[model samples]
Target: MGRRTPSAYEGKGYLQVKASNGKCLTVPYDNGPAPPAGTQLFWWDCETRWFCASQLWNVVPVQVGTADANRTAYRFVNHWTGLRLSLGPATAGESGGRVTQDTCPK
Candidate 1:
């Protein structure tokens, strides 16, 4: 078995989450579904992609598990909407939800 790393997206910076198909997570601006906040996040080919303001995420470290737990995790907050990136169910074909400014679940 492989031991997971203590921290992955910790600290302040941009987070580019790559899919199994080698596409990076992106906030689409052209011909994409417009969320209430205006932009939606999606996966795109990183090599030939163009720059957009929504692509930048503010990485913030949050305490993992209980407060007494020494482990650390992170939340990717959108620089535009200030909403923390959230994941949906692990089921297949779920394309995730809109970026909303909500508190990080404990």
Candidate 2:
């Protein structure tokens, strides 16, 4: 028999931390809402442990809603890491859509 693949896999998520020092870090987005205020998000990259921009400051989501068919934004901060992050103005990017259809063999 051929090599069997692993049946289980681990899920991963990114954390964007903002620091009170006016620094912003971009990592990954999680399913949760956001972190609380006054906390630092610490992550060890290589041998250095750093936090994101949002994790530095205390930023919370003023309004949490859905985005359009295009994109969305948010204003949040890291509680554990004390990172700061924000959602600025909205701008459009390359626009286009493609629809794929499948046909069964006759």
Candidate 3:
């Protein structure tokens, strides 16, 4: 994965994260309006097109409550949906995950 700081961040500290495939990582528009939990993420052309704003993320360092605590873990916060990324398909693991989806809390 790679990231580009969109001009929109304007030194505000958000990142537009993308993959080697040249696609921006974003939530699915198919499940609109703002998909629910477990709605798997999707890849798009990074066009700044409608529904693509969810691709912007903030990298937050963890300072507490981890197995090792003290900056050992990080969280990626979605700009649009305001949800943290999550691993889905219950059976997924470190080897690989069937999907990475974000939960929408009501």
Compare the candidates by lDDT and give the number of the best one: 3
Which ranges in model 2 have alpha carbons more than 4 Å from their true place? 1-12, 16-71, 79-106
lDDT of 3 by residue, 26-89 (tens): 7766545766667677677885633345777777776656576555566777877777778775
Candidate 2 structure quality by residue, lDDT tens digits, 10-58: 1212333324543344323365544443222232221125433322323
Cα deviation at 77, candidate 2, in Å, is 3.8
Query: Which window of 10 residues has the lowest lDDT sum in candidate 1?
Result: 1-10
Query: What TM-score does each of the candidates earn?
Result: 0.52, 0.19, 0.74
Deviation in angstroms for 59 in model 1?
1.9
lDDT of 2 at 50: 46
lDDT per model vs. reference: 0.53, 0.31, 0.71
| Local lDDT at 23 for model 1 | 64
RMSD of 1: 7.3
lDDT of 1 at 44: 62
Model 1, range 2-39, lDDT digits (tens) per residue?
11111333354655555677765666555554344433
User: In model 1, what lDDT does residue 34 have?
Assistant: 34
- TM-score of candidate 3 against the unseen true structure: 0.74
Query: In terms of TM-score, how similar is model 1 to the real structure?
Result: 0.52
How far off is residue 44 in model 1, in Å?
1.6
* Clash number for each model: 0, 35, 0
Ranking by lDDT: 3, 1, 2
